[model samples]
Target: MARRYRYPFNGKRFIGNKNSMEVHDLDNETKNCQIDEIKDEHVVTFIPDTLEEAHKQGFDNGAYCIGNSRR
Candidate 1:
């Protein structure tokens, strides 16, 4: 049997060498344990008197919200 060569960019085949493949398996138990650390990372709410105040506080960037609820 002849070996095959695979080019990442081009799908064309150029015979002779085989590409090495690597497989990574994540440990679910370890991942679950790490996820628990972030369970308490809740969003903080800020009460700004004005929109400008909110912007000054870095909360008006739309990435953060100023409300009584955490979303």
Candidate 2:
């Protein structure tokens, strides 16, 4: 089967922080998300790019960015 997504998951709409284990929605800017606080080292710019994957890896949606949406 063909790949559903491309490489470098960072290009996706959501980004994850390994250190904090929180997922941020790039398209939705929220203060609680604190996207600016993500350090280079903690940034997960590869796999687990989508919220579903992130959550499976024990990541939670940003309180402000993604809100309570589970998608």
Candidate 3:
């Protein structure tokens, strides 16, 4: 399974995926999912020139993950 990370900010939750570059949008997958604290920091790389771009990517990743929880 592809490891997924959640970045919660500004009263919204954002999802990050290694396979899909950039941050996606907040989705049910993240909003309703349980938070599993990881001792090892999950590294999420955002290549976007601005924070907005990264947030957008995270939102997409989250929305997409809801359909594929098997990941």
lDDT of candidates 1 onward, in order:
0.23, 0.66, 0.39
- The window of 10 residues in a row where model 1 has the poorest summed lDDT is 15-24
Per-residue CA lDDT of model 3 for 1-71, tens digit only, reads: 22344432322334344444324343434533332332223424444433365555443434343443222
Alpha-carbon deviation at 42 in model 3, angstroms: 0.6
Q: For candidate 1, write residues 1-71 as lDDT tens digits.
A: 11112222122111111111111111212332222222222222224323444344443222112223212
Best-first order by TM-score:
2, 3, 1
Candidate 3 has an lDDT of 0.39
Q: What number of backbone clashes does candidate 2 have, counting pairs of residues 3 or more apart or in separate chains?
A: 0
Candidate number with greatest lDDT: 2
Number of the candidate with higher TM-score, 1 or 2: 2
**Residues 1-71 of candidate 2: C-alpha lDDT, one tens digit per residue:** 11113443335677777887777777775666666566767777536457777788777778777778554
Worst 10 residues of 3 by lDDT: 31-40
Number of the top-ranking candidate, with TM-score as the measure? 2
> Which is superior by lDDT, 1 or 3?
3
Clashes within 3 Å, all models in order? 0, 0, 10
